[model samples]
Target: MACVLEAPLRMSVLSEVTASSRHYVDRLFDLDPQKVLQGVIDMKNAVIGNNKQKANLIVLGAVPRLLYLLQQETSSTELRTECAVVLGSLAMGTENNVKSLLDCHIIPALLQGLLSPDLKFIEACLRCLRTIFISPVTPEDLLYTDGTVISHLMALLSRSPYTQEYICQIFSHCCKGPDHQTILFNHGAVQNIAHLLVSTSYKVRMQALKCFSVLAFENPQVSMTLVNVSVDGELLPQIFVKMLQRDKPIEMQLTSAKCLILTTLPCLVRMCSKDRLLEERVEGAETLAYLIETDVELQRMASITDHLIVMLADYFKYPSSVSAITDIKRLDHDLKHAHELRQAAFKLYASLGANDEDIRKKPILESGAIELLCSLTQSENLALRVNGIWALMNMAFQAEQKIKSDILRGLSTEQLFQLLSDSDVNVLMKTLGLLRNLLSTRPHIDHIMSTHGKQIMQAVTLILEGEHNIEVKEQTLCILANIADGTTAKELIMTNDDILQKIKYYMSHSNAKLQLAAMFCISNLIWNEEEGKKPSLLMHRQVTILIKKLLLNSNICSAQCIGIQSVMGNIILGVVWIVGVVRRHEEDAESSLGETQGHSDNKQELERHRGGFHL
Candidate 1:
């Protein structure tokens, strides 16, 4: 045991894996079926206990031969069955491992391998297919592109208890998105999956319910369809509602919430609109608004149905903080409910305007949601502050120039600047995102940056230099990119040497997204199609050395090299040279650093390039 642990993992893999290049891997073509079956069982036993064994076995090229064994017509049922079992064991590893198995067409092989009179082979094939389909990155689109895949899978839904459970799991994982949902619903998966809700097996019942949630995710049509399907004299939605009670298992209740999102919408929307007291109406709005706040499609549907957005807007009566509540003791529940309702309303406002530009700038803007959001950006409550800032950010996305001005004005210059350095990183990042969106158009960006240009740069510099994560810094660089796009704002950015230095440092960052963002900012700051701007002599000397170093290492891909070439031409030569470098200063700058410092700086530069572009 001690010696086994000491040996290298690669060499220590089971003899079945590395005995020869084609020992176990090529056993599928052997003339003796009994020998092939025995070999498959040995491999499965060796790989069953650990994922590393499975991964190593796959890396040693066991998947293709095992799949070939399962696909053989002349192979005996016992041989094919054990082949499926061994292949399923190999399928249980990282996404990359499963992706490798899939590249050999395991899905169709498993499906076609199920055609047999033997029950064990069918069970083995179903189990193997389920394992492959369970991967998050499985090519679900491949299942439908073949046209017969769903029909073939549906055929096994009622094969037996084992097939039922495995098939349901496969469907749960495969019904990933809207297109899959549409296809499955059209093929009568709703009735079959709903039938399992009353299944005697607890696992079957649970798997079917989970499958309902996957089908209903983001696809409102499936949710509504499930609501109408009657199972055992109870509507499917009614059965799930009962499952939500405390008497049911916790897992069932959670699954019920996911599957019943659409069915519960109309009731909550109506509850918000009934002629009730102000408090009750606010409670109803809070419940309904919170439900759809995180789902953009649900938000759009709710806003378009039953006057939902208008009803939600009525509850947005500003915040209920210590400043406004004169008698805290007297107005405890009422004020608390009001505050909860306002936060929910803020979230829904953000959701509603998330994708729809007209809704963002029009109704949300017209209903004073923007003003209420701005007021709460400075609130003492963290949830209220972040939600308010988030709502304003969504409203500013792709907004018109006038709408951008109104959002910025309503947010006020003082509050916007303060939120940029908010102690909560969530607030800080959302505020930065909001700033990027506000700088959408060149005209409006120039106008805002002209007035608050210096403060913006200072805030960005503080965030970049601080201990923020790569995401926050990436966003900061994005705002700089936006500012640099404007002719007027570019002047302020160009003057800040610190900002320029940060941009240059990020150009060599290990993270390609950060590198691309940094490169874009520098490019925008120096690029001028009309006047054809050039980098200053000092900046030119620095950036050119970095570019030449990048060229030497061949670290970036063809795409990145092409993108950076434009930035380089502007800095040094106009059209005749490598980068976008200007022609006039080529001779003088070449003698200074462009060509002179290329050698010393190459050795002095930090090792930044990791590998090929993953951007």
Candidate 2:
């Protein structure tokens, strides 16, 4: 009879908790947020583990008010923290509950809450975020586009052991793809997370293992990265093996096996071997290209593996040499095979040399791969041309003067101009990029432009005046800016009226970077740093006035502030020079102080802005 009474009593208590949960949720909008928050916290704990009860409260509208209090109740850290805790409970309830929580900008608000100096508040918010990230409804790739978020979270990894655990869980859920893998790896995730493998807390250590497994799942480069990363005098592989071999639980040992059994690294190397199988080689090349495309460390690692770059570059020489095929019947198949091989090889070259110069350029130059790449750029195949041209761009990036000259000469001026005029905007953009890289530094600009100035300028004018997009035009201005950096090229640049007219038009461009790019040219042409004078004050009078006016109205940000400083310095130097000449040439007391100034409007313009410049 007493046992029968216990069930009724428990039901009555649970009923009261649900009603209290609703009452506090509704009272959350009170003038004082603190009054109802403790009740909310207590009631939330009672209903938290009950999925059905959580779904019922969400239907009664708890999640939205909690988010409001989290975002708005800034003065009360306790209120926000409770709200975050309750939201975490709701996030773990059901798919519908997670969906409702995610619908109202909860992720970004929680991200903001994580920045608070209140450690408890941050922990609550991080746990809430971890719950949301764990849900199938809240996929990470949809939320994050770059490694920026990872970098921010990784910055907080050492705040506490709990922070490390939650952040690792967040990374595990969020890092589901290759892009995320590369991003997290780039933000020092390997080293930071490895330290947690030795943490005294079992939760932190396990979570760190989970993150590595998610990061290394099917990703050979990252798997290799994880295995080799040293963690507190213990290797990651050793830790995993010890977890499996030691007295850990069956559950943990199973997880260790799952995370440690990644086979991608060995498989990728085998797939990339130099057997005579064309289709397999093509697949291998494309996959490896994707793997190392964004990670420079992976590129460096792959380059040191038994002369991998040399072997990849040889695909262009042996497999694709159509003339080497003498048999009549196999000619068609060989030609098809050759195109696929070259395309894949070019794609590899583009990524292999993307971030590192010595990796690909050394082997490519030694093996004379540049000539083959140059020849492929003229191929009628659209993909072959694009990939070939992009590889050349990387080859020329930050290269010495001789390499720039070699790339330009190898492509030949006529072939380059044809590339510029190619009907494909993608190819044209790449050609413009190649030109930018070739003419990137002072010596590179002087040497490349001296030999191909006419044709290059013609290409510039063609792109600038033609029906290309604003990006094409912007890069064209950048090219002009690079030309203006030449010791003797500034004069050559100022002499071209069409280029000058285009520069003037872009000075007022709606895009700020484009406008700054044009100003870069103007700054270069007029400002002479070494001589401390205006080298080519020969800019059209109207162009000079336009620059002055734009200077006062420009909203250029810090990235291009150097352009602004250069323009301001050049214009002031001219005024100061003219002022000094008049002061020195004065012969009598008849000369007034006004004689030393330029036009009155120009003087007032300078005077108005001069106070704003420090130097």
RMSD of each: 15.3, 18.2
Name the TM-score of candidate 2.
Answer: 0.51
**Candidate 2 clash pair list:** none
Scored by Cα lDDT, where does model 1 land?
A: 0.70
Instruction: Write one digit per residue (lDDT tens) for candidate 1, span 1-615.
Output: 011111344355444454543465566556787877877887778777677667566656677778767777878788888888887887776666677677777777887877777788999999988888878868767667777777877887788878889988988887767788888989889887788888888788888888888887665566556666898799987888878999889998999887788666655666666355556565666676677666667776666556666776666553345676687664675665566666766766777787777667555666677777788788888888888888888878877877777777887778877898788999998999898988866787898898778778888998989898889998988888888778678777767767777877887777776776776675565444333223332255454555554445343444555555544433322112324332224656545445424433322221121111111
- Counting only residues 3 or more apart in sequence or on different chains, how many pairs clash (N, Cα, C under 3 Å) in candidate 2? 0
The lDDT of each candidate is 0.70, 0.72
Alpha carbon lDDT at 499, candidate 2: 82
